[model samples]
Target: MKFITLSNGVKMPILGYGTFTMSNDETERCVTEAIQVGYRLIDTAQAYRNEEGVGNAIVKCGVSREELFITTKIWVENAGYEKAKRSLEESLKKLQTEYIDLVLIHQAFNDYYGTWKALEEAYKSGKVRAIGVSNFYPDRFMDLVTFSEINPMINQLETHVFQQHKNDKKFLEKYGTKLEAWAPFARGSHGIFENEVLMQIAKQHNKTIGQVALRFLIQNGIIAIPKSVHKNRMEENLNIFDFSLSNENIKKIEELDLGENVFMDHENAEDIERFFKMFKIGNK
Candidate 1:
């Protein structure tokens, strides 16, 4: 379990278990298994609607609160100062913790500026250890960083071998912000599991394609949260810390970058509107 020190000097695990599409029951079981497998960080969100399960797993795992890094986000619907603050308190109750390590705005849309004000206040009050934003592009990210009282400690985006986010990483580095990857495996799209280059590299290291994909991101200094319901897959994702990829192998993986998003493109206005519409109906 390697750690990445944030701009505020908080140490976060380089790898974490993400609860994206997992059901509440599955999240509880898998999070418990992940903690048993030596995972100290767990990522969840208000939209995930499984924070209670994560909190239950933490309590049942018997790991001290200090040894764990728990993160949750404020959904777009809760993106105002009052709502965000209330939401954070609700999250704390659901998580069964007094304080949170990190709390992020789930998306850049809606009233994110107001949401950020609440987060800034929470950080100052010692309720949240660190504050950040997820799914923010460079333009919106810069706007927040320049205008806010506290610079964002992290900006999590969709990143993987295919969507490498080279330009975004450079921009984030300028503000002393760390980059976290949401879909580290690109959700196994575009035949990622069958990529010849990655498979060949896995053979050389005697590892699986998934392991190779995770290692590639970690080697590039990106924080990744890979999700899996299976305990065996959870263990496999955690086994990436033992090996190193050579410069040649790293270059080969770089060539695998397609420079485009494999999933939803937030840049499109229609896509953005459609996303918000789903949030309105609570479909996401």
Candidate 2:
């Protein structure tokens, strides 16, 4: 239940429930269970295609709208000012909310500057509380921060124990931007679940490897949105507040950083081109 104040002075939960791959039915059920488990932040994106399901759960859960921190992203296809603005309204309709706690550019590709302008306008109009970008590396992130009229308040990226984004964290700090982690568990890749170091740490703390991984990120001031469909796993992900990892344990986990992305790199030319193509077709 810890929170981080964004550059714009908005308090965001340090931990949240992400609806990335959760199906429509599963998203409704999982998000409802997550709220009952004490999660107030819910992160969804236009590309995820489950905004309605999330909205349904929010309404059915009977939680007041003001108590929940809801976030959604503008997809790449809606990159122009007009399109982005229209998409925001559409998202509002789908989410069944009058105002969004946060809205982010889902990816760095396409006319993000145009999309940013829409976000700025929306923020000023009180339709969005905060605005940001996702999957933007240090270079692009800095570029946007430098030229934009309103600085980005958050930068969501691929962050986990194996790829801590230490250098990016420093750059974001310089720009007064907060770091939010998408794949906080590394999507179970690179043997993250079975790593000896994490296993030993988990054994000592009597916690799961996933708990150790999430605790490591949150202790370092990064917001983590670990998604799970199962109610038990969702509750487990929210149970990292009791214990603290010692400095020695933190340093040991720091040594595990590989300094590279375990997921797709947005900087690669082909990858970027393909991403834009998908947006052009509005498939995602």
Candidate 3:
């Protein structure tokens, strides 16, 4: 596995295990297999409600707590200085760890500034190794990073073959923030698994399209966390380190970018309304 040093000097694994929309049982099983297959970076979020499972896996993975990088997010409900700090303590208990490797604001909603302040405090106290934001677009991202006492170490987004944050990447690099991809396969919702171009590239390298997709992001210095319940597929997601994509291969994949988010547009008023409805916080 490769590593990227965040602006804050934290070494984060370039590829990790993501636990999103997973049941507690599923998280326990899959995270266990993922660790056994050589994954040291484990990502879970308070919204995912599976941190307990992740914590359980950590205790049973036979890997020392110091060797693993555990990450979780502060959800919208817990989006302020006091609440964020309190929530992280709850997360640490659920995750069964004294300190988390990384902690991120799950979204741009609620009192994210307050949430960031809490994260900063956590950082100062040595409870979190690094701090960041997820799903922050270019404008919102710049605003937060500008006034932040400590610039965000990373920004997690929905980056994949179709919706490759081309402009976002440019600015993140300019501001010295690392970009992490949440759904590296577009949740397999974008025909990405069998896209003609990606399939061709995969055949040439004898790699699965999933591996090719993840490799492209990792080679570009983006941290990618591809999730799967199947042990074999989990193993496949971690096996992309052996092959390299040539410049031409990288160019071909780059052209596949849709230039827009393949998932919901966080900037759209209508989309935001519907998306937030999925969660029942903040008087919704």
Candidate 4:
């Protein structure tokens, strides 16, 4: 697997496995298959309620803890310094790890500065090797990075072929934060699977549309975590390193960008309201 060095000098895998909607049982099964397929980076979150499943898989995967790069996010309910710090410890216990390879605030809302402080403390104390934020658009990202003691090593975003986040990438580059893509396949939204351009590219490269999509993200220096429950799909996603995309191919994919998000938008008022309501209801 290839890696990108973060601003703080930690190397992160260019590709990973995401446990977004998986239950504890499903996470364990899929993560086990994923690890067997040679995935070293495994991303989970407090909201996912499957950290224990990931932990189970970790113990059974026959790989040393040091060989895996485990990541989990702080949920909205765990938003302040005391809460976030306490949550991190709980995550450590559920993940069955003495230390986390990386940790991030799950969203831009809910006292993220306080959450970041907790992450910074974890980093300083060696409980976490790297720290970052997820779903933070440029404005909030800038605010946090500008005032925070430690700049985020990464900013995970809803990036895909349709929602390319090109400008965001350039903006984050200025601050030395790497852009990581969740839903790199657009979760099959925006007709991403059936898109003619991706299909044609896949045919040319003798790869699947999913492979081409993931390749596009990684080629542009974005870290991709493509989730799948099937072992075959897991293996296919991990097999993109053998071939490279040509410049012409890259341009065609670039033109497919719509410059809009296919999923939730952080800047939208309704979306922001939904987030507030959802987290207020409760968090796992």
Candidate 5:
């Protein structure tokens, strides 16, 4: 596995396993298999409600706590200095660890500034090695970095071939924050798996389209956490380090970028309303 050093000098695996929308039982089972398949970074969230499952897998995976990188997020409902701090404690207990490798504010909603303060405190207290935010767009991201005491070490977004987030990447560069892709596959949207460009590249490298997609992101210095319930797919996702994509091949794939988010648009008010409804935080 490859590693990237965050602004704070913490080395993080370039690839990781994300457990979103997973039940506790599914998270435990899949996380166990993912670890067996050689994944060291495990991302969970308070919204996912499966940190306990991740904890179970941690104890069961037979890997030492020091060797694994565990990440969890503060949900919108837990978005305050007190609430977020309390949530972190709960997450640490659920993850069965004294210190988390990373902790991110799950979204830009609620009192994220307060949540960030909580994370900052957690970082100073040695409870978390790194702190970041998820789903924050450029404007909001810049605002936070400008005002915050500590710049974010990372920002997780819905990055994929279709929505490459090139502008965001460049913007984050100014702050020395690494860009991470949450839905690195775009959840298989936009015919990503069957795209001729990715297909051709995969054929050239004797790899799968998913592997090529992830390789593209990782090659561009973006951290990717692709999730799969199947062990074979999990293994396939991790087997992206063997070959390299040529510059010409990268250009072909780069043309595949539509340069806009194919998923939820965080900048759109209508989309934000829908998101709130979906997450049942409309009243928040």
Candidate 6:
């Protein structure tokens, strides 16, 4: 398991187990299995509503708290300083941890600056070891980095073979902020699994297209979290350490870049409206 040291000097795994849409029972079971299969970093979010399940897995996994790197997000509904802080406290209760390894402002919506301030305070209080943002496009990413007392240590993006996020990587490099990919597979869309370039590379190394895809990101110094409900896929995702992709093949995979998002777009008006509605309901 390779690690990348954030600007703040904390080491984060280059790969992690993502628990985005897992149910309570699924989060608990898959997280347990992930740990047993040697995954130390578990990603969850308050919006996922499975923090309790993740917490349950942490308690029951029989792994010491220190060995695990737990990350969660402050949902859009929990924006603002007080709401964000209180929500993290609730997350702590749900996650069964005294301190989270990383806590990200889940979206750029609402009072994220204020939400970031809460994260900053939490960092000072030793309640969180690292702070970051997710789905923060370049404009918002730079805005937060410029005004914050402590720079964001990570920015999780919608990255995959098609949306390589090259420009974002260069921008993050300027601030010493790290990059993490949320959907490293493009969710199997855009013919990612069936691509000729990727297929050829996978054949050369006797690896699956998924493994080749993950190796490409990890090699490019990007941290990625690929979620899977199956134990076999979980293990396969973890098995990319032994082989290295050639620069020639890396260049081939780079050709797959389309510079577009495969999933939700933050700039979409409907998406923005959805965020507002989701939070408005939460306030009630």
Give stretches of model 1 more than 4 Å off. Answer: 281-284
How many residue pairs collide in each prediction? 0, 0, 0, 0, 0, 0
Point out the higher-scoring one by lDDT: 5 or 6.
5
Per-residue C-alpha lDDT of model 1 across residues 171-203, encoded as one tens digit per residue? 898898889999999998989899999999999
Off by over 4 Å in 5: 282-284
- In order, the Cα lDDT scores of the candidates are 0.91, 0.91, 0.91, 0.92, 0.92, 0.92
How many Å off is the CA of 15 in candidate 4?
Answer: 0.3
lDDT of 4: 0.92
lDDT of 3 at 266: 83
TM-scores, in order shown? 0.97, 0.96, 0.98, 0.97, 0.98, 0.96
Off by over 4 Å in 2: 273-284
Q: Once all C-alphas are superposed, what RMSD does model 6 give against the true structure?
A: 1.6
**What is residue 137's positional error in candidate 1, in angstroms?**
0.4
Instruction: Evaluate model 2: give its lDDT.
Output: 0.91
* Candidate 4, residue 139: how far the Cα is off, in Å: 1.3
Per-residue lDDT tens digits of candidate 3, residues 125-213? 99999999999997888889889898888899999888888778888888888899988999988788879999999999999999999
Q: How much does candidate 6 score in TM-score?
A: 0.96
Q: Tally clashing residue pairs in candidate 3.
A: 0
Residue pairs of candidate 1 with colliding backbone atoms: none
The collision pairs in model 2 are: none
All predictions: root-mean-square deviation over Cα?
A: 1.7, 1.8, 0.9, 1.7, 0.9, 1.6
Q: How would you encode candidate 2's per-residue C-alpha lDDT over 7-104 as one tens digit per residue?
A: 88899999999999888889999999999999999999998999999999998998899889999999877888999999999999989899999999
Model 4, poorest ten-residue lDDT window?
275-284
